[model samples]
Target chain A: MNNSQDLPLKNDIAARFLPLIIGLMVYVGTLCFVFTLFILSATHLWENQLRTQITLEVPASPGASSAPLQAQVLQVLSKTPGIQQASAVPKKEVETLLQSLLGTTLPVDLQFLPVLIEVSLNGREPIDIPMLEARLKIISPQIQLIDHRPWQVQVSSLINASVVLASTLTFLVLLTALVTTTFATRTSLLIHRQVVEVLHLIGATNEYIAKQFQVHALKQGLIASAIGAAFAFLTFIGIAALLEKAGLPSTSLSSFSIQAFCVFALSPFVTGGFMMLSARLTVMRGLRP
Target chain B: MSDFIAQFVGVGHQYKKGAEIFKGATFNIEPGSFHFLTGPSGSGKSSLLKMLYLGLKPTWGSIRLFGEDPLTMKPSLLPLLRQQVGVVFQEFKLLDHLKVIDNVSLPLRVRGIEAKRSYRDARELLNWVGLGDSLQAYPATLSGGQQQRVAIARAVITRPQLLLADEPTGNVDDDMAIKLLHLFEELNKMGTAIVIATHNQRLLERSPYPHLTIRRGTIIRTPKRSKP
Candidate 1:
């Protein structure tokens, strides 16, 4: 005798399974959205770190003291308009970097070690890398200027691809949820066709009948979406904890901005609206003469 | 409002891939008048009642209820028109999930009446139908006669301008049938038109109302016989 629901939708098989399926879909969708956000933030951080830095390599020359070549390159870099600071990388530090890669230590006086200079730019104006390279080449044909632009481009492409993939996955998850709701609503209509006809005979409007289904859908949808979002949040926490334990950075991946939290909070209501709309449309169509 | 609660003109109906059930059947039901709709099995008794309540539209013809042609009326207005008519289906058509009281109060709830008032009225009607104790019982748990009483309570709860009953006395005993007849008479006395479709010759013989008998896909009106 619950006046709120005229139909026995609570006993429905669809009612039992709809929340679970919708919850699973919402979980995947939330993860996809978070991952896209992570990738975007990580890309922005990497860009800021790489944009103002360049590397210059002064190759070793046999029977030539590279000190003069290194000093000459440093002088040329200082004369450049946009260059802020340039310093030669110590040989021991370079040796340690190579040792980490090759897993072997070199002799202290290995004369074949190239002279490396770390260059920092002010980033206020664009630097013509080819012009800078030509200036450095005048000092020695072996000098090479390497800016981070190419690496940044590759990283940006990878990030863009990840974002596209995540977006597509989120879209697919929502579409599946929508289709599930539609089928469930249609099945309910079929199962309760006799009850619906009785309601009609008793002077009930189609809107009246449809409202019952809509209310059922909204209730189920809201509960399922909340459960899904909560589970997704737990997953985010777990992943972040795992990443932290593994000695990796998890801030961008695990931390939610205000906008992200808002999106997550709004997901349930949005999903509920879609489900209610689907139920309403299905009822209207099923009841149509 | 129109003097006639419902009017049918040259109405005909058929199912898909089936022969016409009834054709060129025309009749007018005046306010507060009672009529017995009698017909042989499969004689379209149910179909005629369906058209009366706007449950089924005739394949061809014009029908008016509350002075509005249901066929030409706005679809949105159909429920408002239907609100003035009530039907007791032959199959009982009770929602198995709903309790007896809920089923009886359904018509009022559909009209957006407050539950407190609707349930109070439904409870009083159920008591009159001898279902006061079974108010909390589900339809599946009720006997056929009890369910029929529940349907009757639902149809009359609104005090609709017209009441259409199909085989209303089919599942009841002679005493309960007479009681139901008296109940209909009381509603008719209150200016609510009534139509009871039945095959019970005894009830027909006992009643003083005219009969609209469906004969060979046509309706034939028979005036009430004078008491001996």
Candidate 2:
């Protein structure tokens, strides 16, 4: 006949509020999920950049020239297995980096600055850090072998904590969405109890009544989640723009991977499907005699 | 098919608060029969009609509709039996949000019938009830008599095997009541069993159907008098 809904759900107060609540929850969840994705990508990029690189610091000697010790360290590194390249960091570049930190003034004599060396490994085999330290000590007892592994490990721990926090937040947001759907559906059933009873008396099955609620939930859920995801993507673009305006390198932001895009694309459908399921179950239980 | 459209054997009904409405009441509704269910208020007239339409189940004893025990039938299959039995509630339980035509065609729509066909049949029935122009109007906007007619149209839209009406003509005028009774008569002639529960003495005298009267929590059947 008219093909209109048997229940007047559109007029329900719950219907008006459900979409807004679901949209806000989806926004929070999408942000959390994207944050986790960004953290994971950044950690992966850092690991790849730091995996095969190490830095060496040669202290200045009072009675000997540090240039000779730096040259000896480079010679030793070149002869070692798995050592791809070795070179000293320019003293002037180090001095400029220090000036940026210490107000553009040389606090002490330039000769007192330690000689710094950059080392690259082939990455085919793991370097023996303790053995390298011993070898460097033979060259000069004041030499320091500073591998990047410890720093990377600390960064990894911090990133892992952030990912866990984001994931937990996303889970709680979704749970809240489900609870909201359930409560809204139940309230709708209560409000439309008489209409529902009329439908039941008119040869309508429970499944028929449930189908109405689920379809409403699905439509509302999809539109709300789409809006939420769109806002989240816009926020991402805004953050990227802000970073660029602040003179930060574009590479500092995590690039969107295919996985992240898929997550964003499927979020509406997933949320809608979940809401439909929740509404169906809540209506079924509420209609139970 | 069973000769009786409905059979109530040793049936009893009681409220949850332990108030027994009726006990050991037995009745059989044959196919294509029209009977008036009469009693004073609070005599379980509505309850009896409700049990016939599968809206309420007997607290004890057996009820067989369309040759199947409803109490023992699977809950999911109850709608199938309910579909075969149409009920017009005294309250005219129409959906307030739906337009008059939509409310009338709800039974057909619930059966998964095509919208065009169901709406056409609903429109024709509404025209017959003299509310053709009120198709788009909601139930809340209609008078009590018009709402009752809409309820009647909805009940008989499917041409069910058995029809149960509770005070079907209580809100309508004498003329409209007679017209509505004629509609039910036409349905009964088409092999539909009809049960009307009412206290209207004039309406009862107007028709020559047998009576199922309730007195002291028991049913007494008064067969139709033979024409002289």
In DockQ, how does model 1 score against the reference complex?
A: 0.56
lDDT of 2 by residue, A30-143 (tens): 878987987787678779768888989899877678877888888888878888998888878888878877866548566887888889889997788889899999987888
Computed on C-alpha atoms, the DockQ of candidate 2 is 0.65
Q: Residues B59-110, candidate 1, lDDT per residue (tens digit)? A: 9988889899888888878999889998898998888898888999999999
- In every candidate, what fraction of the native interface contacts is reproduced? 0.70, 0.80
Any runs in candidate 1 off by more than 4 Å, and if so which? A57-124, A139-143, A250-254, A257-266, B1-3, B15-20, B223-228
Specify the CAPRI tier of model 1. medium
lDDT of 1 by residue, A75-94 (tens): 88888888889998888888
Q: What lDDT would candidate 1 get against the real structure? A: 0.88
Ten consecutive residues with minimal summed lDDT in candidate 1 chain A? A250-259
The alpha-carbon RMSD values of the candidates against the true structure, listed in the order shown, are 3.8, 3.2
